[model samples]
Target: MSVFAARVCGFAEGGKRRHQLRREGRLMLNRFLSARSAAVAVAVGLAFAVTAEAKTVDPKTSSIVRGDAAALGFDPAKLDVARAALKADVASGKIAGAYLLVGRHGKVAFQEGFGVQGPGQAAPVSDETIFRIFSMTKPVVSVVAMTLVEEGKLDVDAPVSKYLPEYANLSVWQADGSSVPAAKPMLVRHLMSHTSGLIYGFITPTAPIAKAWAAGGENRNDLTAREYAKVIAKLPLKNEPGTAWNYSRSTDVLGAVVEVAGKKPLDVLVKERVTGPLGMTDTAFFQPEAKRARFAEPAKGDAGVYYDYAKPTPFLSAGGGLSSTTEDYLRFVLMLAGDGEYKGVRILKKETLARMRQDETTPEIRKAGLFFPGPGMGFGLGFSLVNDDTLQRPGNGTFSWWGIAGTEFWVDPKNDVFMVFMVQARELAMEYQRKNRTWIYDALVK
Candidate 1:
């Protein structure tokens, strides 16, 4: 990839690694990240809320209803190019296995799986293969936060300390390993857009903050989300809150904020509002022991797993902790595509979804720290919006994000197109995203 393309995160590049099943029956886990930004689009259209009580979308939501190339406004010949190119990646050993589901006009035109489930797992990947959707978790949690905002349980403009005082009076971290008082308090909105200045402590093992966090037992799974936030609260920040759009543990902090603001734990809030309402049955912080076999592992030597799915751990990493199936996540996406309502279940208002897509950062802030969304994009509540197509291929008003593992999704309201591409190739997420977009764009005749 070109240097510019390599910087496409949310749209990110991948590296190689492998891991065997760890903890015996429990599977190992790892985290990966992507960043990209975009311009806003007009709301597709306001979807009227169903008057009847909301219900979980059936588990077999849209798979059986997939349309054909001609019927769905796609060029069959061009789509074959996309098909062959994706399968070629498996032949080249770039990914262990993957599946891509493409939809337009509320119907699927194409969906297919590509390789074996994992390193030693014999099952071939299918619609049900579960993935550790690292940074993609950010958008899910952000959507949940908006639900709270809609309910008046949380105020985006309020200081984060309103909910968690532990985050109060925090200092900024300087390059020289010294600290100074922050110019202003971090706001709830800053946490959602990644401008809170609270970065991942373990990103650079040798960094002073990383060392400090490790010494304070920050990585212990035994710590609850709230306790994890407390450990982060005592640390200095990378920059002033709301001043820079650094990819940090801001969402993780938002989890704690949600707990205090909603008077319930983060996982509980997500389940009650998002997963449960939308029938995203397989999406959660921990995978069940019976479902461990369905977990997709990265190619050998590509990445390491961070959590054991069989055990109930306490650290709810709202930033990168959840595992989900393509079907489960697709229901969540349809809600966004449907302007916050899936099937009959409404989780957020159309205006709130649009608000999430509007740019929330300045150009200077996006470029300030670890800016990974690449050129021609802008940061929104949790995902990147394409202002224009100068840097990437997606249409204007397209919003998207991805996991560090070879997983990505983009919804182009303008084109009535969206795709969910899932893979365990931690090192190839960016290449795959660009490839996936190109394939879909070329294949579409609409």
Candidate 2:
């Protein structure tokens, strides 16, 4: 039995206090009914019933369950220790709340929630709580583009201007406040791998191009995808396309390309090609009115501001505009872990997924140390590929990424396991993500 299962079983077996409490309550009820008042007896009985329900624990459920932790080759004790540490972190006020799910060999061994959703919010985080996944949306968008690639509707190596004419000619920004024409056109693959020389305006407010981006108001919810693209194209790029690895707004440009190729709005195309097929009903650019109660509030100390998921935005940021529940995202990761199919719903062919997972960072970029997330990882088509086991705790070949609001997920194919951690605060996101990596790997006995 898994440690969680065994713990539940042991509690049931040793619950003498529970039985004694029930017996005593029953006797008191009978005495009250016989001697004094029937109303008092009913009230006492209801109290006892509530107490009993409070002590019960529900069984864990997963879409796929091959075996328990021990049967799947894991140390239950080590896993418990990791869980305890996460709970401790919450109690210590390092974060507001967190939810974790672990699946191995197709079976879910650990799925739990801890702490309240946010300060002044009485409800605790649960499996169904929705999070602002932020940059994590890039992987899904990248996958959608790849589907077009599979259908011969799009080409990754083609210059982005082939479909989006606004990008046909662009200027490169120089440190001396001058601009030069780009030596080469930006390609689709460059956008996917974040080598398109685009930079987020919020990252460096003082840069001339960044200032221009902010001034243009490209990210306002009132702008359409094509309109956003037009504004971005007018700005000077930080580097020549495909020459340097810069964390950027390239994915947003890719979204505009997807819209042009698919002939549909990015939101509709994603629903048709990805989320709808995968049954990720809770994932979307805007949270529906009905789901407002389940949306987690961002913790007080987040470094950056976030868009209101409850309202529609003018531009669907393929880069960071997505909100999803833990359960829904788990389904998405399961599909990735299962090589692009979830319960026979094929989002991408196995070969395509393999290509997506391969590190696309050129040796030149790696040698220059321009790769985001630093030395131990390299950029893939849409995800970060683990290049060194020492830096990234997961096994090599793990594909992973996180959001600014403390949400993270990783697919470790070598270990046949995938894990996700969700929290709504950004102040300590990186710290918690790193801690989760260490704790999760420490529990892997096999």
Against the unseen true structure, what C-alpha lDDT does each candidate score? 0.74, 0.77
| Candidate topping lDDT | 2
TM-score of 2: 0.82
Q: lDDT per residue, candidate 1, 35-136, as tens digits?
A: 111111111111112212224455545533576767888888887887788788777887778898988877888888888887667798888888777778
* lDDT tens readout by residue for model 2, 301-330: 422355456777577888888888888888
Estimated TM-score per prediction? 0.84, 0.82
| Candidate 2 segments whose C-alpha is farther than 4 A from its true place | 1-66, 302-304, 367-370, 389-392
Backbone steric clashes in candidate 1, count = 33
Question: Model 1 off-target regions past 4 Å?
Answer: 1-54, 60-64, 202-218, 389-392
Give the CA lDDT, 0 to 100, for residue 173 in model 2. Answer: 85
Residue pairs in clash, model 2:
221-314
Error of 1 at 108 (Å): 1.0
